[model samples]
Target: MKKLFLGFCLLVGIATKAQTVADQPFLQDSADKFSLKEGEGNVNLLQVGSDRNKAIKVLSSQGLMLLYEKNLRQDVQYRPLLDMNIVALTEYQGQFVYLTEKAVLSNAWAGKLYINHGIEAPKAMGMGPDFLTLVAGEGNFAIFKNNQEVWRSSIESLNPISVQYDPNSGQFLLLTAEGLYQVDSVLKTAKKVFDGSDLTAFSLFEDTIVLGTTNGIQLLDRKTFTLNKLDQKLPWTEITSVNNIRGNLWFGSTKGAFKLREDGKYDYYASKRWLVDDHVADIAEGPDGSVLVLTQKGMSKIDFEPMTLAQKAEYFQEIQRLRHIRYGFTSDLAMRTPGDLSTGYFHDTDNDGLWTSMYLAGELFRYAVTKSEDAKQNAYEAFEAMERLTALPDLKGFPARSFERDGYEVGLHANGFSEEWRQQWEKENGRIWQLSDDELWRWKSTTSSDESCGHFFVYALFAELAPDKEWRDRAIHQIKIEMDHIMDNDWYLMDWNGKPTAWGKWNPEYVNSFPINVGDRRLNSTLILSFLQTAYHFTKDKKYKKGAEKLIKKYGYDENANRPATVIGFVEGEDLSNKWNHSDDEMYFLTIPGFVNYSFTEEQKAAHFNAAKSHWEVERSEKNPLWNYLFALSGGENIDSEESAWWLREFPMDLIDWKIDNDHRKDLTKIAPNFRSQTYTEVLPGDERTLHLHNGAYRNNGGSDGKREYAPYIYLLPYWAGRYVEAISAPQAE
Candidate 1:
């Protein structure tokens, strides 16, 4: 992946005509990883009882613990019963009650401690209306009322797993693996109501008794005791816990937690994107319309907030301005420890120019549509970053990939090239690091097509969309100089050694040499043509126009550029040709707007538009906002804004590169690996998968240890692009 960074790392419905209404609020999911602060919450919130309350009581390895919302979703605080070894906990009459091996206590009454009626080592407990029940084993049970022992039972046939109290029925039900049993108030005797096995969880859904078995769900009429079984249609079959919060059915399984929607669909929350671990221990309702799920590792709160796309843009804009920008460039935050922001330090990448340009493009688009001063200032600052890149290397027209202060030159980061061979390769590729003339900085050499593509793309955006005339002039000038350098050098980016960098070649010699199945032929032809066309559009220079037309008419680059990406297949002997080059996709989409918008004639626009349409047809399945919006701007219709909105709303607020694995999911329909490496029948939603940027939405699984936090450009670029094209509207006021 080279500049694409192959760091051993790495989907929703469509909207066909939903963007017509401007400033409308759309649903967005905000994930609360329930990030643990030291000494604040329990290591594991293993809820053991059947108490269905917003205040969850549990038995942690640290002893007894009570989970509470402390600082919203950022910090879920837990109070542990450190001094006492408590076994079970429950809620009775709106107060927390607890049981130890020896006795029972209530946080509501400090001076009152009741004996457990010889139900030692209690593991399960429940309370309802005026009754408290504790179970130690299959046959041992103790019932208490108002701090007094009421009933004790020894029934050998009962193997109690959970205890639930139905408020409507005024009855306490004890659930065992064998069946459901009802306990009467008078005898405190247990009678079998339903005959079933492998039951794991129980909850009362209004007047109905909800039973969770290993395979499916069973609902019983609280008064009639009649049963209704539900089909095993769930994200995961093995149900570990079930709870009804405000009439909504929520279930926790071994894989993830899901909410049963009214339409029989489930809103699944899994992976590090939603929870700390997929193994959900328990789930409960939390403060502010949030759903709290306790996992094998820790807790997570899925917060549902109503906001417009504009509000979301502001949120991400603030995040980028706060933590990601470095020297006006969108930079990745490197973390010394996994998932720790305190250890994060902003760092540069080889494609800093490319990424900054994308961020800059989004800002310019934002300024054009919203006229926000902050957006304008953002564009100006990013434009300055692009300017600094051109000047840093001290090369007249060739920009450095990135630069660092003196003595910060690490070994070469060339993907296929080796460190041991750095010296031998330098002779051919030129010095990978060159000392700045001032002796205070070092610039990375071998500037790539990624940087080139990014420079031109943003330069065109700033020239066309930036509100300020002075800024537009500066961008237009840079566009001319950069294109002049590339064209004058025979369509190759020359390093200090006067040789083309390995990947900076866009000449017909290099491009046309590739076979028809190879992507570089089409991509390279499109790029150089776009560069020349954009240069001519602003500069109106005959050389730029002649250069673009020469490529199209003389070398037949028009044909090369119009082929669909589906034509790209495995070219057995070549390295890059062995797989689809995703970086090339970014290069093409970013360059196409410039190419199509600046066409020399109407016929040319029609032809270039054909090229864009072909690529979009291939990419349509991904439902990428940036790509789709770019297509809409290219005069295509029926581009789904719903898919665009779904992508935007489902994107997680968390940007940390946490390790994720979806390969083990049983709910997915697995497919044999294809050219794109697609593994699932359908792509999962944005919130459920890893933060893959443009490279993914196709890959099913990837792992990272919070070593790097991604820049929000991935979200911002598409959002503003969608906005500029009117594919997405401004946020509506509340």
Candidate 2:
């Protein structure tokens, strides 16, 4: 008996919180708004002026340093006082004042350092207009004017965390772990305004006080003295310091830094993109709206604004140029890198035809949207590459995995080979083909159903959209030959050995053998219907329609098409549906356009749409940009325009398959391991997950190709398609 799996209940426990306008104020946009500078060691404090024209000071392990904010340069231009054991630095009444344990530096204006005598050693200090309040051990507090003691007082709290003076309130605020207090300048009374334990940091706004505690941020209403908690959770709970910079709240925490926008949403910066270390010591707003982040490793300046769509389009175009010149072709065995294109090393890929077809489709959409000759030329070149795959194989209409030069056979290994397979290649002269006059070109055999789906999908698009008559005629011819071969071979893709390819079975005997709930049964049924409908529409063949109707009526392929994908954890046993195959999801969604566009009747199209909708609903949790774009193009419900834009922006500038490990991050919220879902509360999968895993199994898999880099097509396809479908608006000039 097959193990039973629970379905929708699993999702109910893990569904993401509803996104409200108040909660998600910022639409996640991508742009170059941040830059980093590595200091000698950890930076402990940063101070900048409210005016955008002032110089910023940084205190690190190296010593006191200065950085100019004129052009956002990262160079450390001045070290006024180096190798000094400085306790605190502050600006009081337009004058720079800093202190050490044994000495006091007073009014060190205009690059000159001066010492002031007659002031006792103070543990902490707060600056006010023309005066400074010093706090020493044992609750000793004193007010000094021009280095002379004017008044003195005593308080009960021995451990004071920080001291700040609010000009509007005309009082000094002292923060302690026990509570917050307001002290007047007369050397006497202290008023306890709010009582809170475990207080780490506090920042005073005009009428409110923001406190950072072990829980999260707490807002104190000074007039009412009532405390209200912020519902927005930080990436980590241990909030270290809070700074109110021009109305924006910057929360520095143990894990990273978060900036809460005025509109109530937040932006996070951490882990190499904006921070050299995760531990944020302090945060200060720079002169030109940039933020200076002091971390354990160094300081990073992040401009918190998002990028415009025009900039994103330009970025995508540049990536395309780099990829086409460096990593465009492939040879044999789906080796991840496919050889470096820049240095003249080329290899074959098992699905070069399939992958290239998707890229070609993207270019077709780009051409349609922009009317750029460059896009048309790119589509034409990719079409030529795919067409070569079908011609290089020995079987009349079978497509080869890939083709390459004859001399490069160093690491070629076929998937499931027996002695007969080796004999066919070495003795009987089978499986390999020489296409060039000098016999320099060779092609690998054994094409699967994935290649077939890609071929038909692209061919249908070419037939409908290609501007040149020659291209349209070639597409139709390819479609007719491939469909005829499959039908003639009893609905299976026959390999060069006269045997059906392992994944090329779509016949009734194969598809119907699986149970109704199996993923393969549903996936194969949807694909075959799409293939038949496409062939009939392009070739105007009645036999193709007849085969489709036979499958729908006799074999319940239509019912299979409408069956919803199982919610993985709900099912038990080793069922194929128990795990998610993102590859199958890609094939399933890619086939929908052809299936709906070429259906024989409105009823048939409606059924395909319903199936597409059901599949997309299950897939929405993945937040895949490509899947969302395709679903929107197919007229699915609740098209996520904001999310699609986010995916394009969040896609890393580097397409190289770098090893990313997020399992060790402490800030992440671990959910029950579900093999079908990639959703996590800490970060989006697109931000940290591997590109290959987007189409592979989600569990027990060491995600990503460690040796190779991905091409730009992964981003270009969805971006162009979204542009063509008008799901994404054209970016305006800034």
Candidate 3:
């Protein structure tokens, strides 16, 4: 199945609600205005709204706080003129009730009420004491005594849909989707405020009213009708909801939600993926500065500071373990080809018996610089083996993929196609042929799919090895060609091969190759890191310097685009989509630290730091432990902070964390198993899965010489980042 239909449906269900607008609203009259403020935490949350002559104040759950005019005497007989009942009460969303016979409030107010009510739908208001005024969603504002309406009215056209009493301005406000207006409840007359504007989402803070338009957020001064453009950063299609948490004015929009600066400026903070979707379904502050995000998929909570620290410790440890594992495991295998007298340490243990361990060897050499011994011997050996393999002619183009005794004779042909371009030319020029005696021989073959990473390793290995002037020159040429073809202006790499096919056709590429791969921009960061590492290692070259600079400017950071410092790629499920059902709106801020101190300018570093704070403040989700640790490493906070302590406790499962403690951290036997699994649906017949599995097994053993896994490259990360490298290079005896 294409999965597109299911994906679309899931996207709609979770993403549609993200387009609702909710911002601060204002209570104002012809000459006066006041703001609405909500309190925080364990303290009673105060709700205040005002019109021209009267003020309304409620302590929320604690009942009415105060209801005095701007200039009213404190000793005056105090009483609530209206006896409306609260229809709903929640931490963020609130509602009130009144009778239907009462005059309707403004449609603007009505729209606000409906949106705040969420999916519960409106409850019917009953007829009671004569209705004085009516407020729809913020709860009932008018009083109804007995069965008749409260206040006497002569204006025959007064049929408002929503009404609210402001305590600061001492006036009555009416709202309708069509326009916003004011009413004199005592005089029984109405006057227009703003007309012809679609005020779908609104928030009131003091005398200022925030309106969400189809394009962006608009701020209006209630007393003067002065309009101020609030959001000019990017396209803001919908304001799903707005609320004040702690001191931050949080905005939930169609394109994810953001936290605004408390100082009234437009500085924003949020998860990298907040803008990936068009609408933000829900937002709430979690314990210890964590953020709760409810999108279409489900609810996810993240604690950034703590999570980042934990993951960093974990990731660093994993790098160490993978390094040592590679080093120890490579001593166990024997090579099957005629060239190498040396034997590899790994052997097939889980699948059909066959030895194909060179891939792991190649990957290790690519990332050997991190481990000292790897840099000393393992890396050189792996390169030596690859060179020998490349030099040997493919006497049998198609060898039998089987490992059985009979299978050994199944292939008998020469396929000159090699891992390098030389073999490619030989295959294309018809110099390669298959013999009848060959077992794995096929008349035609396609360059291996999913081998782009291999090519990356090869280039990385070449650059790192730099055996001589000739080798270095060849490496430089190859690196440039690969970079020119695979990287776009956006700094995103094409996951597919760039080489022309038999038909001389190039594969189409996407701006981001995340989803099609493992949903991680590790490759992007890898390219960036590799370029920077190459530049740092080979300081004589200016091209590497330019490459590093280009990457920073192209795919670095953007508030409007909602890009965060660390990116964990995008997930492809229903609970993840935004209101627009567009994948472009989603991102996870991981991989930030991997590039945090590498190849970035001061401005870039500052931006990345800000993003790290935001990720910790709002984006770290419970579903992604890896994101938290990465954040912690880049946070630059105290190593023993509460967040750091939390990370220290979760050091076992995380490979990075485990390595930090020298692999002394123990895994829970009953909780998480140590075994790993991967499906090979596209496996070729007779291909040895056991050797592939073995090649990957040694990564966690503190040896950096595995052939299949990229443990060596990972093992080298700490060295480049100024961390421990010996963890990846320790000998097996030690």
- Best prediction by TM-score: 1
Clashing pairs counted in every model = 5, 12, 145
Q: What is the C-alpha RMSD of each candidate to the true structure, in Å?
A: 6.4, 8.7, 23.5
Q: Kindly list the per-residue Cα lDDT of model 2 for residues 261-314, writing each as its tens digit.
A: 565545655554445566777777664666777666556666534555435555
Candidate 1's residue-wise lDDT over 1-734, tens digit each?
00000110111111223254365675576676654456745565666332434554455666654445543122124243466666666556556666666667765556364655577446677776644554445477877777688878776756677787776767778888888888876666778898887899888877788888888778888888788666576678788889887688999988888887776667778777677778777777665677778777667777788878778878888889988998888888888988777888865566778889999988887777779898898889988988877787766788888777878655366534666677778766666878888888888777889888999988877876777789889988998878877887899998877888888998888989898888888888888888998788778889998888788888988788877666778887867687666677788888887777667777877888787888878777777888887676655567777777777776778888877666665556788867776667776777667778675557556858768788888899888877776777666676
lDDT of 3 by residue, 45-135 (tens): 2222222222233323334333334321121222332332233222212223212222322222343322221212222222212323333
Error of 3 at 702 (Å): 36
**Candidate scoring better on lDDT of 1 and 2:** 1
Candidate 1 Cα outliers beyond 4 Å, as residue runs? 1-18, 21-45, 48-58, 66-85, 102-105, 109-120, 130-137, 142-151, 167-170, 186-189, 194-198, 205-238, 262-265, 409-411, 415-424, 571-574
Instruction: Report the Cα lDDT for candidate 1.
Output: 0.74
Give the whole-model CA lDDT for all candidates, comma-separated: 0.74, 0.64, 0.33
Question: Where does the lowest 10-residue lDDT sum fall in candidate 3?
Answer: 659-668
Superior by TM-score: candidate 2 or candidate 3 = 2
Model 2 Cα shift for residue 716 (angstroms) = 3.2
TM-score of 2: 0.76
Error of 2 at 397 (Å): 4.0
Sort by lDDT, top down from the best: 1, 2, 3
